[model samples]
Target: MNLLVRRLFWISFAVCGTVSLVWGHDVGEGDLKVTVLAKSSDAWDDKPLPHYPTGQPEITVLKIIIPEGKKTPLHFHSVINAAVLLKGEVDVHMPAGETKKLKAGESLIEVVDKAHWGENVGQGDAEFLVFYAGEKGEKITHVLHGDETPEAVLQEANR
Candidate 1:
């Protein structure tokens, strides 16, 4: 009986492992549609997208949290990004001197070669889930440090 139980346990483990491998989480098709604007752009002159990618694809899941009165500074992702705001309000500043407000449950598809800055515009912290698609080895963001630029800030963070 002890040997039989051990064998059954091993079988169950193997089955579970196989199932997990075979059934990877499916990225929703609707999610892909959100970033169509960025993905469809022909000019990818941003820091991360020096050249259009043409091979293996990569997906990055980004969870950004901005504390009250804190800002995300100015930056952009290397690949096209589709994002959904989870909490609070965030103001996105375009390089062209335009600002747009995004609230919880709202989504955005940023265009390629665009520079931007983000700030928490609400009284509380704001959170967001961002999905990006690009090549494996690309720089995701460029920091504009000049005060004159619309999205100027110190030290750029790239992922």
Candidate 2:
């Protein structure tokens, strides 16, 4: 009877230990969550980022606000730039007719040296944080007149 009782105790202990090891660990929720918006080796158009000018790097960050129904002039970034929409919605249009709509909490890796424009399409004001990776004294953006072609712009930039 003593041997049987001892055997039963050991078996129960082993079963309880195994069950605790398998199911007793805590799986608690975290306070904050992070989502990656964009991760790319190239720009939106699949082109490599342009080389930074030979000088100390200059970084520029701007909080741009676009009133409802407003549109940006056709322009292009000479340096690598990106933006994260903070408040509302915007339609980004390229000269080649491609368009992308970005909303709050979304981010974009903008095209470099490509002509494009942005229009606020939301009911309220649109806001975004634009960041430029450039060199000091270099022009970060070039706004085009209505009739200018990208070829002409590139030529002027080279001269």
> What tens digits encode model 2's per-residue C-alpha lDDT throughout 39-157?
66477777776554555556678899999999999988887777889999999999788998899989888888889989999989999988776667788888999788666887888
The Cα RMSD in angstroms, rounded to one decimal, for candidate 2 relative to the true structure is 18.9
Error of 1 at 7 (Å): 42
The TM-score of candidate 2 is 0.74
Model 1 lDDT per residue over 121-156, tens place? 887889987766666766555555555332232123
Stretches of candidate 2 exceeding 4 Å from the true structure: 1-33
Query: Which residue pairs clash in candidate 2?
Result: none
**Candidate 1 at residue 28, lDDT?**
57
Give residue 40's error in model 1 in angstroms: 8.9
lDDT of 1 at 7: 40
lDDT of 2 at 21: 46
